[model samples]
Target: MSYVDLHCHLLPGLDDGAATYDDTLRHARRLHAEGVRDVACTPHVKRDEFPGVAVREIVERVAHAQRRIAAAGLAIRLHSGAELAHADALLLPASDLERIAQGPADARWLLLECPFDGIDDDFALAAARLRELGFGLLLAHPERSAGLLAGDGLARLRPLLAHGALLQVNVCSLLGNHGLDVQDAAVRLVREGVAFCLASDGHPGSREQTLQLGFHLLLRAGASSTQAYRLTQANPRLLLRDGVTRPLFDVEQRALAAAA
Candidate 1:
């Protein structure tokens, strides 16, 4: 099955991802070769960092990118998305949320960027607020978060899971590119069935964005083919197709995104 990547920085000139249109083309070609047919152009959306990245502009960029990639005869399909900052998610308008949402209009699934520095008290508050505002969250790179990794990591993770947030482990973390700590957390999340899916979280030509290598590394890291396919293919596909996906492979993850 073709892989569907939900957290790719494939759009050029947006955030720290692809730098130019040509860079995007090269990235698309590589992804196509890796059997990735669909990609989400998830640019960073943080008030302090990417303050100028408006939702309307992201849509326009994706539309322009779709045209460019198609003309290049690449089979890759592009979708609009943004790695929304927790601070911004609390204030962005409902209409803007709908525009940058992952799946259909009714399915408000937000790719919430987990803070790399340290997850403060507001992280859970933001997640709960988003859910209350009718948005499902895909928490990015929890394995790398200093807050989640320090002292009883799983214990801290439980509250977020109870809040209906789905964990998205980065592919690079699985391969130990981030460090032993990140790799261990990532593998443990999968083994314990806490992770909801695997994402490239790819930006331009970064090696971590290389899905083929990441998949192989995951295999070497002790994930079976069934787990790999579920993480890379089935779960991601369903999330993009329907906004919310069920845990067909992990019973422990079943409580994710369920209505209270």
Candidate 2:
């Protein structure tokens, strides 16, 4: 079975992902070996850090890299996308926003980075404002946020789902690749059915085998085989269409059954 990665830095030179065309090809081969058929080329759109990265530029570069991937005979498909910074998401002009957005034209979606350094008050306002502008939010690696599920934590995170946002947990975080807190948070989110999907969020230095490891860990950490498919495959494919998220009731009900 193939998987779709909603958040991955497979495109070269835009961020900390692939450095060159060769690097991009290598990442694609690795992803293909791991059974990933589709990947979103999410270069960083953080203005302060990656000020030169533009929506049009990212799209063009992705196209160029895609041609290389095709010519190389890799079966991987790369979709043009960006991981928008909190401030950039709110401040970017309408034209840029339109060009960068994913999903159906009527109901688009954007991947907003949930800062690992810290969470700020403006994060909520950005989510609200973005929703007002008619784009769905798919937060990147929210479980790795520094202040995970603290005093205002669940208060902040629960609203993501309430606002129709999808919380994407990184596969590495689940395997304790980030830290204990992140791993714990990842587990909690999955157990509570709060995590909408699990993504490789693969970058240059990150492990390529996370897809296989993530599937195994998800099964060990409470997800059934069917539920793991939903998290890694079914839910992500819907990300391009209004950031759709379906329930993991199959596993939840199974747990309930076991409890009863």
Candidate 3:
């Protein structure tokens, strides 16, 4: 089955992703080979120590990359998006925010990345503010946040989930590319019904086979075949189409299952 990647850094020379036009084309072909036909070229926006492109420029870059992919005889499709870091993302103008949405001009999905160190009160406030602005938020890599993994870490994410924010886990995290802790969290999120989608989050030098690997791993870790398909394919498609999530594992039941 073809997959939809909601978070990938495939744009050339924009932030820490593909470094050149050639790299962009190569990455596209690789993801296509792995069954990823549709990808969101979601480069980091306003991240510390990394240069983020403006939303308009990011949209333009995706278009340019699409042309290059077509010239190279690839059918991979690219969409415009940005992984907005919590702090500086607040500073982006409303117009730029409108430019970076995935589908139509009114698409509500906004891919957001919380700090790697942890999620705290301020970050939650920023996310809440974004939601208030009418965006249906999709969180990126909550597994990597140490604070979210500590004592009641996953518990804290429930309120956001209840409010309509979907979580997107990195496939590499499930494969231990990050670490055991992150891998554990990733698998648990999928198995317990907390995470809505699995993404490659691929950069220039990463593996193309992660989509397949993560899918199988999720099954091994207790995800049903249907749930596996949902995370890798169906849920992402729905998010792209509707800018909202409907994971096979019910979000409302997560806490109940965990408590039991």
List, residue by residue over 140-258, the lDDT tens digit for candidate 1: 88898874555555566677676567788888898778889888888877776677788898988664366666677668778789888888888778788777533432333463333
Error of 1 at 67 (Å): 0.7
Compute each candidate's TM-score over C-alphas: 0.91, 0.90, 0.91
Candidate 3, position 125, lDDT: 82
lDDT agreement with native, every candidate: 0.79, 0.77, 0.78
Candidate 2 wrongly placed segments (more than 4 Å) = 207-209, 245-260
- How many pairs in model 1 have backbone atoms within 3 A of each other, for residues 3 or more apart or on separate chains, i.e. clashes? 0
lDDT of 2 by residue, 1-260 (tens): 78888888887777777778787788888887888888888889887888768787878887898899899888988888888888887788877877778877766888889987656777877777887887877888888888776645555755555557777888888989888988988998787766768888888555554465677889888988988888888888876654432343333334333433
The clash number for model 3 is 0
TM-score for predicted model 2 compared with the true structure: 0.90
* Candidate 1 overall lDDT versus native: 0.79
